[model samples]
Target: MNLKFTPLACLLAPLLTACGAGESDETPIAIPAYTLTVNLPQTGTLCVDSNQNDSCDAGELEVSGPAGARQLQSQAPGLLTSPLLFIPGDPAALILMHPAARQDGQHLTPSLLSSLLQSRIAEGTPPHQALSELLAALAPLQPNQELASLHRLQEFNLALGELIMAVLTQNGAVPAPPAASSQTRVWPGLFILLPELSRHFANGGDLLDLQARLEAILLQQQPRALVTASGVSTYSDGTDYLLTDEPADHPGQDASLKQQPLRYRKLDSQGQPLPDNASQWDCVEDLNTGLIWEKKLDDASSPRDLHRVFAWEFGPYRPTQDELDYACPNSEAICTTQQYRQWLNQQQLCGIGHWRLPHAQELMSLQHYGSLHQQGGQTATLDVRYFPDLGAGANGFDGYYWSQTLTPSRRLESVPLAVITPIFWGSDAGTDYPTAVQTPSDVNALQLRLVGEVTR
Candidate 1:
């Protein structure tokens, strides 16, 4: 969508100025004649307030960005996104500063941030990269500040510059560092920046949406696999390995589903597990989804010490009151959704480059929960026999998992406020954890977890 701005309103304030004292002439002023152009952020209806009345009057002036008249309306709303595509963050971050950053006597101002951005831009840094550095600079100072509200780039940059300057000029008022606590807060800049980051991921700009579109074109006729076929004959959960008994070509899968034993080993396409000496971390293949997952237990505590544990985190949004006390599940390790993908790529899990965080629908597809003994009630929503260790350990966040979907609160649109989390557990009536009709992301659930995948 393109918005072309034209300053053509032909009116002035009710009060006027006398042009000549003797003539007692009163001349009405006209709005300035200027031209401005802006690009629409997405495919949406455009309305311009032609009369400056702050309302979209009938046949009002153009409200879209500089693109004159071109606009894109998506029949499929899920495909909405910014700048046309989604990519993991590059070197850019958002830095917003407070309108009044300094005290009565301080000299630091929002302009410093502007200067930093200007210099970075002059040096050829992309706006995004410049933003990343600006936010990074602000992160170290008051890194543990609590997030007070949602943020935007413009104001955030102002506050970021303000915080850095204030920290640098500190007169020994910094608090004593607390005794060791994993609960220490995260960087304020990051806390504030995540929501904006999440917005960039909305409207089909993300990998999930990209894959969905691609999958439609490539596998339209094929059924989507939600329930996995273990191929382990010992456990016949009655899951149909085949939608039908007729021979089928595995268009989505390179390997056919062949029955194996419960003691199945992680394998590459050639069917081999990680070398025997270092088999602690392993993968699993979902014959149903043709996607490989990294077992939740396969991460940290590895003898090899892969840096699997990340800081507890949230994407771009503030939490509600009921969500405030919730911490990342003890069952989970603090890892971001992005790292989950990077690891898959690094390990070349199942030898596939496209291993990614699952979409909400894709993640929920795994939840075919029933009260069968093997399922172990609401506590273990997945097949515990095959994935027996999932909810067992001291820190397992058994019935919850992350999805690569960003959603807005039910009431607001401009605020792309929440990441979708899927509940793998059962009713609260039967369990300790509160049950909800909808599963929203737990802001503190950054380490929520990664399910296992194969060698691809």
Candidate 2:
């Protein structure tokens, strides 16, 4: 392998006594520094580890984007620690590494996982070549070795996730490192239970039986099943689990990353901060996005009650009598989404006057896709802790939340559509994936969640 070590210039002339070279025949040899170019997936951070802590420190050479050059100061083979780590934009993205095998002009890609490839290099195969062989070897393993291959793959992913936790923690990110006890339960659960799953499958184990066992381990482990991607915190309900979109590193050339969970701060009616554990709050501020969201109330007397649904008054069609009855059950004057926004602004709900319907993307950001899994008959798509007032609609699923965006299709001008996202699913009902849907702006009785810009 070609090594790209750059030569260091001599500090002083050997003939000059002032340089301290005349007193000794020996001269200090400078350690060679290697540079590598990292190509990220449109977004992510790259850190060249100088301290070997595996995290990007304040003064470390760090870059972010699709591509950048980082200088690796340590030339030592990365037997134990990664010399370079590329953290992708997604919080759950598998941390890719420039394996320990130092090579010149090594074009490092995001698909490289340090541990497995490094292990191969320890056996004397070059990493680039080893990567190729490993990819080829991963293709459809023999029946006898299938279980073993799976176990190995899981181990590598877990090890890589541990490294990611270290990086996140060192950077003061939210995810805490998994405790040693968690690691203990996680590994043995995988090793012991996987074979059982395979055998059970071989013996005609039903899908529900396998699911129950897998769910049990996921629950019994509490957190860090070692299979769940890092960065996302465990939900109060163990049924909510986020499966990483990360492809097997050995076979896939590129994969999407799991993003860090969005941080939120609760606010009271006066726009004052509340403790995260606070049982009551009128609004939630997305710390990552700097957007504040309105919290629906449980009381029907309040205009912001979760049960009240409204039609978009600004649409081409007017609300039908049934729509008005559902939105303003007690014949409240404000029966439409526009009227609700006006009332909220007039009252300056949560001490913010600019509250308006959120864009579709902004509203969808609150959705927790992991909640799609069927568990305990709970089917809300958002974290109930932060957004406690989302209620089942007349149709029995979590009600739809209206967005300001209109649909792009060229339907009849009189039937213009507005975007809405389903916030809940009925047990044994609803689509497999929760996403935004377009409905008749004036006819659909959708709920509204307002968002506002941060006031600095």
lDDT of 2 by residue, 1-456 (tens): 222222222344332222432343444565655455554433678776555444667876668765444344435434223455556676544455445424445445433234344334332333456555544444432232321232234433444355334433545567543332323323323433444544544454532354445545544322322122222333332332343343243232112334556567999888888999998898897765667888888787887887777755543445567667766677889888778888999988778887776655566566665554442366666666677666765433345666655442223355534343535444532222222223334345667777875553
Residues forming the 10-long window of minimal summed lDDT in candidate 2: 222-231
Error at 82, model 1, angstroms = 19
Tens digits of lDDT, candidate 1, 365-388: 444333243344445444444344
TM-score for predicted model 2 compared with the true structure: 0.41
Judge candidate 2 against the unseen true structure and give its global Cα lDDT, from 0 to 1.
0.52
- Candidate 1: lDDT of 204? 24
Stretches off by above 4 angstroms in model 2 are 1-258, 315-322, 372-376, 395-397, 410-418, 422-442
Which of the numbered candidates is closest to the native, going by highest lDDT? 2
Alpha-carbon runs more than 4 Å astray in model 1: 1-281, 298-300, 303-334, 374-378, 392-398, 409-416, 426-443, 446-456
Tell me how candidate 1 scores on lDDT. 0.36
* Model 1: how far residue 289 lies from native, Å: 2.7
Maximum-TM-score candidate: 2
